[model samples]
Target: MVENSNLLAEQRRALILDEVRRRGGVRVNELTRRLNVSDMTVRRDLDALARQGVVEKVHGGAVPVMEASTHEPGFEAKSGLELTAKEDIAREAARLVAPGSAIALSGGTTTFALAQHLVGVEGLTVVTNSVRVADVFENAARGGSAASPAATVVLTGGVRTPSDALVGPIADRAIRSLHFDLLFLGCHGLSVEAGLSTPNLAEAETNRTFVASARRVVAVADHTKWGTVGLSTFARLSEVDTLVTDSGLPAEAREELAEHLRSVLVAGAEGPATSG
Candidate 1:
């Protein structure tokens, strides 16, 4: 009886996920009605899906996780998600930067947040393929304090991706010619199996060049990125030196990542706590 009941529940959750993907989003009340399940049951299913990183929970409903192997969301669409977590992760990533080092930043909302924190760093040279990230520094340079030297910002020009990334041969050639002290990368998904992946093939190639040009690489992602897989894999987990993520990442996931990464920093209100 218990086995049959569990199987039935699994079937219901599968249907719920399908509905969310088909309709873009679904309300808890509607799910309960459609599934012929109680409100509490529907909520439980949503919670389970959320924990699996397959769905996002909204105010009174659930939505499909926007990231898929072939689907990439635009910068504006992604900027609104996990705002606090991104801020925390960015804060932690910024600490890895030194005053006089040259670094490369890939395009993503999390890296864009990291750019805001780096504007005031003295004697910094930033090479990026992200228009949004470059703009943050460009705007800051115009209004920066005279006491501090302005950071040099380099924008690698290429065809733009949905996430505002400049990718393709033009960007790749520029990155390959320059070497950076560090690379701060943001990805559509991170899993032990896929490592750092993106939905865009051109962006993946561009990111590969960025990784090759840097002495060290730090991946910046929120908890939601865990377990997600994209169409192309750029770097494996072992290729990255560190990972900076929010505290919301499950303990087991953190532990697994620690085994593969040199350092895993969990960002919090106080600061980032180091593991591995």
Candidate 2:
């Protein structure tokens, strides 16, 4: 009986993720009626998800965590928001790339921007789940801009999320067999407490695999992500080897991050740049 109850709870939580994905938010009353569960049960489930950083509990319902802080905007939308900031962060990230190295690039606007700078890097192998990032490398190959031997790019196969990340079991399975010299990851939110997080649960799960596969982890995010807390925590602040962010990060926050992370690279002056 206990096992069956646990199964049911897991099933219900999966449904809740689906519902929230489809509707953007879910009212407790509606969930209670739809799941045929009591109001207390629905609240309990929401509470559980909240603890995992998957959803934000509202006054009477729950909203997707992406919507909580700047809404983890789409690729194009996010790309435009922090152009200069991302460029600076990307440039700094590119500096970390070594020739003849294997690396994983997780999907996010900042990482995508970093892909732009990596085009000329020689003998690099890139494993990524972002269609856009792969396209950049592919186009660069076709353009033939002197990346002698060219960069090898691997695209992960999986369900695409709102943030344009390919995730789920297929992506997870693909990453498990590989090891990387570095993993340049992007996150929707970052904090001293919650660590690195994203709004999508599957993306978060896949990101954890990226963390496990890489010898070093470098986070590329702008200052805007400082206080935002997403629905899922993929890694803690201490787990990251380096943080490449813009000057916009408050002094206090930078001091805090510097204390935990192995190194923190600040980009240009703290204004007019966008980040994920």
**Candidate number with greatest TM-score:** 1
- Please give the clash total of every predicted structure, in order: 0, 5
Model 2 Cα shift for residue 227 (angstroms):
0.3
lDDT string, candidate 1, 179-269, tens digits: 9999999999889999999999999999999999999999998877777789999999999999999866656678899999999999966
Off by over 4 Å in 2: 1-72, 145-147, 269-276
TM-scores of the models, in the given order? 0.80, 0.72
The best candidate by lDDT is 1
- Overall local distance difference test of candidate 2: 0.82
Give the 10-residue window scoring lowest on summed lDDT in candidate 1. Answer: 1-10
Question: Which pairs of residues collide in candidate 2?
Answer: 53-231, 53-232, 54-231, 82-274, 248-270
Give the true-structure RMSD of model 2. 14.0
What TM-score does candidate 1 reach? 0.80
lDDT (C-alpha, whole model) for all candidates? 0.87, 0.82
